[model samples]
Target: MPANIVAQARGIVKSFGGEKPALGGVDLAVTPGKVTGLVGPDGAGKTTLIRILAGLMTPDAGEVSILGGSPAQRLDSIGYMPQRFGLYEDLTVRQNLLLYAELRGLPRDAQEAVFKRLLDFTDLARFQSRPAGKLSGGMKQKLGLACALVSTPPLLLLDEPGVGVDPISRRELWAMVAELTKEGIGVLWSTAYLDEAELCDSVYLLSEGELLFSGPPADLTGAIADRVISVTGFADRRRLALTKALDRDDVIDGTLQGRAIRLLIGEGHPVPDAAALDLGPDTKVAPTPARFEDGFIEKLGGGPEGTSKLAAAYREIPPSDAPAIEAKGLTRVFGAFTAAKDVSFTVPRGQAFGLLGPNGAGKSTTFKMLCGLLTPTSGTGSVAGFDLRRSAAQARSSLGYMAQKFSLYGDLSVGQNLDFFAGAYDLSGGDAREAIERVTQIFELEQHYKRNAGTLPLGFKQRLALACAVMHQPSVLFLDEPTSGVDPVMRREFWTHINGLVRRGVTVLVTTHFMDEAEYCDQVTLIYRSRQIASGPPDALKAQAGALTGAADPTMEDAFIALIDASDANRDEEAEAA
Candidate 1:
């Protein structure tokens, strides 16, 4: 290992009695004052490699070095944060700090200074007395990061620390990590978000236990620069154009960006012509800058194309002029704290609707009310033309829901789980067998049908969850952060299936932290501080924020952050006036 390298791994390999090794002859390095990103899809051996490097697990074969010592020998000099950070929920912020400080072997005399610095750095000084469980998602993440830095370790390992964090909080977390790197701390960040990978000083792209690429993010993106382009003038048919383009042999990948279809074509192909793609003649194609995700998907053999078999099996509901979903003055209160206040929205049949918000912003509370998982403290909601308060069971029966976390039975086999969910949905005998057979074949789960759901890869688990949700083929679907930790390619696959369902007259109400995914919605309501801040179509909202930001093209993320900032400023001004 070089003197500048803080940690190094050579020929690392590990397997868990599977046909493929978890990590096969992988090599990686971390240097001082730099962020080295581990970028890959779920089940890409990232967690396994990180565990081996953290000394928590031993590799079958490998040479490792950490700060001039073995990973196991230098445990005290490394800060490691796993995907599910261990924060004591009952403990107050200060108490959590004290406990971590003690665990890190910090002397009592030195604790106060360290604790104060962490609290100030993480912006948690005012919340020191509050229990960890009472904090928002972003605050909890910051506290976890603070705990890992208690001893000021030389190297830090973060495994998907920004999974469910909103754009604003994600940027805040990145800012903190960036500050640490400036102080000569080496960091290894594992993430499924390719945009984060693009910001790293260097990146190790892994897939299926192999190192696909390793270097500056720009280098990978540069490979596809000439082949990338954005097609405009598709108008309202942009989604249809994107689906059509991706199905072509020349087009390697395509996604809707605002009103344009961003595409990645195969090498040696000329720039796509509008007529060639069956788009109207007014459509214009212009070469666009390639992004890290563009390259990532291209390398993964492109995203899924064509309509979903699962969606094709769906049965359309009867036509109705009434909104498919309606929430009128819905409010929920826990004690004196209002989780959702007078929230309202309407979704037409076959339309994709989005509910977006920051952490602890009442979106989830509103979602739960619509899902029939929680009764609103006041107000009313309806699903599929059925009143929620009066016909909760009928409304629930008309919808399919995929929770934020995997909600299927982990102990059961994939086939068993399918059987169970089918039965629960009232499908029995011929109906149960048909639905099971349909999902298994459509989702490509036959290979793992007998395997336990718990042992399946993250991507496979997600597939199983979605399959179970759609077993009954309900008229409405509720997806809560459906692709929270999934890679770009897998996310695209899921959305493609969703789009197919929408075209078949199935209403979709989804909530996601990924702003890019929000662009797919026909209508969106942005909630903050338990109230609606903005409600409109995606392009209209983007245009509204663009007017304030003075940008020609503002992305969904830009609009989201701008709206929140504006909302905060207004609240601050009101407080000052009072």
Candidate 2:
């Protein structure tokens, strides 16, 4: 007996002008009322397959059935959200909904009810009159989602639904997804965040255009549950232990989590005892449970922790006596709106400094001022020891910047973009050719050089953007939410390149929503409502916030939320007093 399948694909194959096909003989099925996850590395064919399911593109060789009918026939009954949802920013939220509703041919009676339900569920009712362009990043994403759901289709195809959203908004979006499935609407969700995959009823793992495995998320990781282990060594010997562990063929992957090293070993591989690595008698070793990430990384051949030799503090910048970055009483304004207010901070040589805040919290304004893209309305700032106001050209040349959007030339091939950026650094002929070759290999962009920058998967685009930004190896690097839509596996690899740069004495200032990634920073500065809220080491900030919240120990995410809540409460009290 066949299970109740809402959508199915067999022998799916697709090619996008490459030696390798985008999808190679893949298979998948969607069950009623269940969320099916499609996850894989960038260019693993997730988007290609989703397009096929949505009837936007046809597979070169295969069969696809949506609701047990030809995909074309069921197009009206399906709701699809692309990675970059094309919401008309100039239109008001309600206007956008009206457009989608009209397209679905919903009568006035149905349209009113659909609008009410979508607005309520997405919590966009209050902002329905606001122009979509005026909304925060998170709000815009929610409005886009509401537009997709306005039709109340029986099936949903969402590609990376939570991209670039903060954790709280991300949770809210997932909650909405869960409710849709409860109404017996089958959903196919593709996500870069592997943790989200665990929430799906079932998952299909893709890699290099083929299905590697398909089953419950736990089943994928739990098979090697006993192989995951934690090894504790003295702080002095931790690096040595990591080197030795990674040198072994059995050690699949390892990372420094807190004070201990967590290892994901292959099946049948013995746990790495500390004594084997020449650690003192005080070393502790214990088995740890495997996670979906462990299995995913292992299956994908994720090896040895990634860190860049050039970016990981391998060498010191010559003649580096001044601080890498300095900001003093910086302020920016647009008419009556104050985007950044009296912000001040500093980053010394060879340090990884993190800047974090929620959407529209003045982060972008402040970043722009520091990058010379926008002049501060008042006060001053400097990058790479050059005053942004007085020496803008030197400051610009002394640093590399990667905007949150990846800021690549959409129409250019990967090689062309690299060549253009390389030219900006004054490299040409043999020098430009050498730099391009080096970065292409370093970032594993050799195969993607011919691909259009904008057409690559989000993860691959992230790698290319970073490669282009660092082609000149500037002394200071500013990355704004660089991992917004990337997966956990790729994030780790991206940081390997960053850490390598830090080691080479390059100064780094990064903004990110992933608080866990903030743990890698030497210091973190928190901003809220255009003002600096807190600044210090990651652990210290968390502990202080934990004390205030009455939690003995709080994770970074919890501490961040606590700070925002506390700060808002204080501001309210102050307003009442005034």
Candidate 3:
């Protein structure tokens, strides 16, 4: 039923360097003036399909047509944005835009008009002169989007554009997308997030390089609408409840939302009653509608039915009795720009603390200082009782840091990367080898042991990065956008490991754009424009924002947006008073 098909593939099959063909007899279509989603988990051939559509790769046996001809011949008619934005770090925002515009051969007048429109919509006008390398992650994503939109091609291909972006930014980006679609520009969006697929006009579900299903998200979700059940309790109890619920044969998957747990019941298994399962003296359960994610999980074998055990044998607890991480008036400056201004916070031992903010807000700068990667301009901080300035090595020795970018030698095999990180953390000989083996099993990287780190899928890369960072088992863990680009099911499993470690006394300092992930943290801090604008428990933050916005029991996303709005209002008031 698609019209004006801008991109289409039939019986597509592709293989890579003598390996199994990533794509096998796949068929796809994208129409003008509509948003089409290519939804799949890691290693599902979504990337392979995108490559063929963009003429970056050839199909072993199939035909791909773009704008009625071969994809390679339609480069000027389509705009593409890969997962990695491919921006020149040294180039200024304006410079990058101009370069992309020139590459597309847009006239000078058309380029100026389009650039102005893009900067305005992306909210990057003020940062035009700033170097692309210096923009925050979220801002950088917007700039990438702007660059892709420069020529406004008839068709657009966006690959996971919202992977690590915050919900607010994601919404903003989608708003721009909606406008573009109305203008009759076709969009092919690839994503691992099932929830995002629901926004598309049509969705093609891929699994293991084959089409699992293709249709509207509503119809897909409706197929399993009768399976979901809602369970409620306080945060601590909710987590315990979910962990315990997994024991039931009927439970497929469960995700925690503040104090509530949404569980998917399996058709083949029998569900136990609440009273029989010890759901406290006061508890209730009711059937709820299924989400696209619930259906996706059901299709994928219900995911590790029994509990996935998470236990850490190594511990690096310091003898001194200071908080796990302490930053008092921490400040860091680059040239004339203050990346972190008067930031102070304390993460107690065994607590999971989340650092959140818009791009370019200094969260990474603050994280670097605490992890000993960068020195603070002023103030003092310590990790596990080791002063960052006086005992920088000691401080870092007690902590593990996973950077936003998967920082590992791409050419090196997974085993080599893990071994290297283990050595870097001072683990060598049999101990390092054993540690590598343990993490390989725990992180589910056994099959990819001999594969090059870069050659593995995005999800596998994330697993490798986490494995390398945690190989030494530091008492304090610093995770930056750790779950970015991971599918929902894997994301749940990843959090299970984090929570399990927290139970065993590992303190976590994490930065993430996923508000749901923030609920897992014991505390949340929102940093804006290089300052800590707000900090508290998730519920408390929501309650305060709810009080002002009249939103009853607001979700974390709602609360987060309200807090930013309030901060902006305060600035306006101060300026008016002056």
lDDT for predicted candidate 3 compared with the true structure:
0.83
Lowest-sum lDDT 10-residue window in model 3: 311-320
Ordered by TM-score, highest first, the candidates read: 1, 3, 2
**Candidates, ranked, lDDT:** 1, 3, 2
TM-score for predicted model 1 compared with the true structure: 0.98
Write the number of the candidate with greater lDDT, choosing between 1 and 2.
1
Over the stretch 380-440, how does candidate 2's per-residue lDDT look in tens digits? 9999888999999999998889999979898999999999999988889997988898888
CA RMSD, predictions in order: 1.3, 3.1, 2.7
Q: Identify the runs in model 2 with alpha carbons over 4 angstroms from their true place.
A: 1-3, 230-248, 256-261, 278-287, 304-315, 319-321, 428-433, 446-460, 544-554, 569-578
Candidate 3, after superposition: displacement of residue 24 in Å? Answer: 1.9
Model 1 C-alpha lDDT per residue in residues 359-405, reported as the tens digit of each score: 99999999999999999999999999899999999999999999998
CA error at residue 142 for candidate 1, angstroms: 0.9
Over the stretch 1-578, how does candidate 3's per-residue lDDT look in tens digits?
A: 23579888999998776566678799888999999999888888887888788888888999988888898789988788888768999999999999999998889878878888989989999999999998866788889888888888888988888887777788787888899999999999998766679899999988878888888889888977877887764336665677777667778787766667778888865545567556676666767677888888887767553344544455534443568999999999999989999999998888899998876778989998899988899998999888999999998888888899888999999998988898899998999988988888887788889999988877889888888878888889999989888877678777877776776678999998888788888888999889999999888888988997999768788888889889999999999999
- Give the alpha-carbon lDDT of every model: 0.91, 0.83, 0.83
State model 2's lDDT: 0.83
Candidate 1 lDDT at 450 equals 97
Which candidate should be chosen as best, given lDDT against the real structure? 1
List the lowest-lDDT window of 10 residues for candidate 2.
306-315
- Tell me the lDDT of model 3 at 44: 83
